[model samples]
Target: MIDFDYLKREIKKEKVTSFLVYQKGNSIFEYYKNNKQLEKLHKINSCTKSVLSILVGIALEKKYLTSIHLPVYSFFTELFKEQMDSRKLDITIYHLLTMTDGLDFPEFGEWNSFAPMVYHPNIMKFVLERPILHPVGTHMNYNSGCSHILSAILQKVTNMKTEEFANKYLFKPLGIHEFYWYEDKMKINKGADGLVLKATDMIKIGQLILQQGVYANKRIVSEDWIKTSTAPYFKTYDSIGFYGMHWWVNKLDEKNDFNYENTYYFALGFGGQYIVILPKEEMVIVITSEIYENSLLPLKIIQKNILI
Candidate 1:
């Protein structure tokens, strides 16, 4: 049996604001440093990208987006009309979804790497203008700009802001209210980060994915999309595991294959925010924290204390 009291002590030492473990539709363990945090909308950071991935699947199912293979230029015709690079036209929705767009905008490996694109006068233009360093769709680089462009694409095709589209379809169905999604100067929702949500609401999202896009007996997105989006498309960083559309697949046991049923996958954020789903164990884990640097610390704590 897992030691809840020991886990709470470990989490508290690590400065985690919230921690919860849900097994078979029940919260077996929960911890919050402050009771007020239960009501607060904490910033989830890059976990927003995973949420945007779900929105993309929903849009496809709704027929707002026909296919992931469609070239991004098809959505933003005006943006690419004057573009010089022929390769940019080849970048598709699938590339953006998988973070294999080959864009040069780097989010990691440098201090404040994401700031340059976020602070640009026109975020979409900044992303589009970046030269393609790697062959499109072949390499997987962690780029926030790709996700932002996705948000822009969503806005273009759906004729609604990303926040509005999510509210009407995703959030409402999951009963996720009292949330905030920040937008750039262009007023496009930040798909890469800047989403704030309650920790409990995070659990609902994990549960939704756990049920294969179903929530409360309602089909929010198709099961096929969930399986497709969460599959290990590319081998990611050694420490980070695999990358699916925007979700992450991690093999806790080295011997195990990266299958949906065997391994755990998660939506991770920069500052220790996480929604970890272990399908084989029939469990979901939610953790939100304030540690900005050394973000992986919380995961280590979880593995040592809970996942063991």
Candidate 2:
């Protein structure tokens, strides 16, 4: 059993503003700096990517989109036709989902601090025109632009905005009441980032995945989609871990004395939002924090205390 009291004390000691943990569809623990007031919706940042991944899975399960193997250019000819090089035409939806589009866009640092690319009028055109740094599917680069393109593609195929599609397929089905996604200048949701939800809603997402896309005995997303999305698609940074369709894959070993069964995956956001799901343990840990730095420390503690 996990020591909720000890975990709460440690989190408070570290000055974490807000934290929530769910285990097997129950709120196992919660902590907050200002417990008197209701928690406000905080910016989830790049955690929106993981939400987009789920939306993509739902779209596929519904046949709104054809398949992941379809070339990205096939759907968005207007954007990719003359702008993208011939070599880039081979890029597929799978590559975008795996963050292996070969584009030179990086999510970190001050690259676009001077000018926000998401607000730019010709954002897709600008992204399409960037020189290809490597062959498609050959490398894993954390590119928010790739996710943006996916949002556009989703809009094109479904004939509805990504937010609308998500609301219809995902949010409504999951009974998520309060949430919002930021829209680009063209009024498309910035699927690479800009999603906000309460910490409890975040936990529901993890629970859905832990149950393999089933909620309340209903198959919201196909089991196959869940398995495929959570499976390792490509290697990210050598130091961090493997990337699996917008989810992070972590391996556990008995040498580490972890109670987990060697494999666990999680959805990570820029600030300190995590939706960690351990299928074997039937555990789901959802954490929302204001601490912008070293959010993974709490996750490590959970692994050490609860899972191990």
Candidate 3:
């Protein structure tokens, strides 16, 4: 069992802002820095990516799309007919999900201000024009642009915007109230990121995945889809780290670590928002923080308290 008292003490000691944990759909622990319930409508940053991944899975299950192996350009051929090179045509949805698109773009650059001068003119055109540095499926490069491209594909294939499709099929059914998705100038939700939801809603998302895409007896997503999304596909910047779809997979040794084989996967966001799903322990951990510099602190605390 997790030591709630010590966990709370450490959170307070380490200046954690808000933390909550749910095991098998039950609230097991909670703490707030200022003794406040984090608004259920706060921006959750890139946790939105995981949500988008779920949507893609749903799209696949519905047969609206074929498979991740299909080349991305195959779906958006008309948009890039003139500029689509053989290298670009080689890119696939699986590459996008695994962040192996090989397209050139800063994964963490200052795009907010630079959007006016560069991206606003023609985002897709600019993205396709970038140099491919590696063969698809051979490298793991974090690219927000790749995710946005997937989102655009989702819109084109589904004949509905990502936000609308998710709202109707995923969010509404899961009771994810009060959320917003930022859009590009072309009015496409930056499905690669740019979603804001409450901390509890984040937990709900984790829970939904933990339950294998089931919600309150309703099959919102398929078990097969969940398995594929959570399965490790590529390693990120860190050596031990790997990514599965849009989710980050943390590998821990069971013999050396208490929660070994537990396989704690999570949806991570910038500025310290996380929805962690510990399947073996039947636990879901939700954390929100303003300490962008110390975002890993919350994960470290949870690892120490529950998985050590």
Candidate 4:
């Protein structure tokens, strides 16, 4: 059972804008400081990468792309030249999905830098032109530039804008209609950030994953994709836990006060937005917050109040 009173107190303390708990096919609890904010769109920062991962799965199911193993250069042939570093040609869709493209793009550690690519006029070129600092697919570097490259690849293969494809295959099917997706100057949806969705919509996304890519008896994406995408492929930052395709996986071995062990995966965004899927508990926890400096605060609150 969840301690709602304690949860509310903690949430209020953290200044979380919205909080939701869905379990066993029902939203067991919901809290919004301002009820009107329930339907308001909130920026879901890096969670956009998880959504793009879904779109990529759909594209694969539809045969728009043959395989994730396919070299990214095949899709973005125009971006490459004969004189370019041949190693860049080795980067695959899998590399981008896993954030191991190793393009010398740093977004974490003392090298907390993303403004260069974000502000560049030709963002795709800016990302691709970066020096390959590590061997492709061997090291996991937290890089949003790699996520943006995946968006560009999706657009190139689908022959439609990433947003259009998402609307057709993902959003509309999941009953998500009111939302906003920001695109780069090249018109590719920002796969790393800039997706605005309501807290309820965020819950829907979590539910979709919780239900193994099914929603309302409809198979929105393959179960294989769900398992594959959420499977932990690498250990990320201490706070972020393990990294999957574009998702974050965590396992809490030590039982909480209730003596319940927990293993879950989540879609995390900058500024405290999260869509946490707990398959064992059959629950989905959605949180959107304004705490920009401490994006993990919501997760900590959830752990203290619910997971414990």
Candidate 5:
């Protein structure tokens, strides 16, 4: 029961580059005003973290890493000096996934903010050298550093680049072959931002989550990880409901694009990139825009016009 006219109007009003709605394994609506945009790959900002989250699941499934609770420092012992904060020793993969790693990461933590190391010769030092800003697991700081550390862990454990791992375990299986990742000077996947994907590939991830780690009749990711990643494990400092792994979640506002009393969790990025999944409705919404805005406008359109 999508209001197509309403959707078109809103996309025009907001100048959204792409809007895709998928339900029950089908794309019900897709709109792009310009032909060039339709063919161009869009940058999905922080949503890269969520995609890494999926890779973690795949890594865990294949036993590249033992458990999420394992201490991250153990995997990268060379990164740490002989003397460091004892509390830092407590940091774990769970903390990284939840953005609770407690490094004093500021907004835009990845661009050029790291201390003495900078992103020049070694990006890993830039991330690993960060001082512990908060206690482990007490609060959420919305960190890209944490995700990068997880990426480092994946690479160290699997002995393969994160993109290679993803290509094997995630993208190839999902039938996604075309994409590029933002790499640091060290050629490591940024694992936080600068992932370019086609609109269809973006929604493919949404559909994968909606199907609980299954795609094309094959198990792509672990169901246990998917369920645990989507469950509201901890509340965010912002008004955004709970954050599970790298996903933002909130309760169903029945008045919104969802008529049923169900919850929705989405992978959001800067400048209005989103992959929102309304689990109860079997609906997956992909929105890409150039607004440099927050989450309100696209959310409103989905709530107001496309819920039922």
Candidate 6:
């Protein structure tokens, strides 16, 4: 068994609310503090993007999305009120998924200053108006606007909202019945943030990824999609190492397939929400916190204790 007493002390020292661990198909450890409920439906923040990653996989398999290679603006041609940049047309769904859209969005984090683009009547338009700062596929920038456009793409292709399509396809199959994905005024679900799910359900997401996109013996998404999504497609400039579709990958050490590597690929949120999957260790860790700033504390815990 793991040491929850020490972890509880660390969690008490911080504003962390929930911590759950699953290994070998069992929930081996769990902890809560700050009067956090076991079934609390708190927003996972940008961790929501990773969920959208899974939905993209499902959409691909179901043919809701024609191809990640398709140009992003192709789906929303009717919404543009002004002439658009030719550079923007070069962006593809893969660029959005990988956050290489090169959109010069000043907005970084929610805690950052809100500009006109955010509060504008239409978010998709706001996102599109941002100047292309770099050549598409040549730079890596973390922008939520790309995620929102992706959500909009889901709506355009599926003719259903992001959350609705996810519920019908991704969430429902995994027995995730209780969850809420907040939307903007235009009824477009915030794809980059605003998904509220219980800690258990969040772990189920990690579990699904750990299980190769299968849940309860059912193939919710293809195993090939899981591999493709988690593969190290691009290496970020930061220490996060490589980025896969939307998943962060750490292929630092590998010996054999099952028992050799200590690598863990995870979904990270703005605050501290995480769904860390260690394929070698056979472990999945989910953490939710209120500490929006310096969210590295969770990663510290995972590194110093869990992964060690």
Candidate 5 achieves a global lDDT of 0.81
Cα lDDT tens digits, model 6, 77-168, are 76543636788888999999888888886554352623354577888887888888999998777778888889989988899999999999
- Residue-level lDDT of model 4, residues 173-284, one tens digit each, is 9899998989988888888997889889988899999888999999999999998998888886877788999999887663332112456889998888999988878899
Worst 10 residues of 4 by lDDT: 253-262
Off by over 4 Å in 6: 34-36, 106-117, 252-262
Candidate 5 lDDT over 32-103, as tens digits, reads: 868887768899887888999999999999998889999877987877764277777888999999988887
lDDT of 4: 0.86
CA RMSD of all predictions:
1.3, 2.8, 3.1, 2.6, 3.3, 2.7
Candidates 4 and 6 compared: the better one by TM-score is: 4
Model 6: colliding residue pairs? none
Question: Whole-model lDDT, candidate 2?
Answer: 0.77
Alpha-carbon deviation at 1 in model 4, angstroms = 2.3
Report the lDDT of model 4 for residue 212. 89
Against the unseen true structure, what C-alpha lDDT does each candidate score? 0.89, 0.77, 0.78, 0.86, 0.81, 0.82
- What are the models' TM-scores? 0.97, 0.90, 0.89, 0.95, 0.90, 0.92
| Candidate that scores best on lDDT | 1
lDDT score at residue 219, model 2, on the 0-100 scale:
84
Q: Give the TM-score of candidate 2.
A: 0.90
lDDT of 3 by residue, 43-151 (tens): 6667788998999999998887899898988877876686645788888999888888876566544543122213555566667777888886788876777777888
Query: What does the lDDT read for residue 217 in candidate 1?
Result: 95
Q: Give the candidate order by descending lDDT.
A: 1, 4, 6, 5, 3, 2
Which 10-residue window in model 6 sums to the lowest lDDT? 251-260
Error of 2 at 25 (Å): 1.6
Runs with alpha carbons beyond 4 Å of true place in candidate 5:
108-121, 254-261
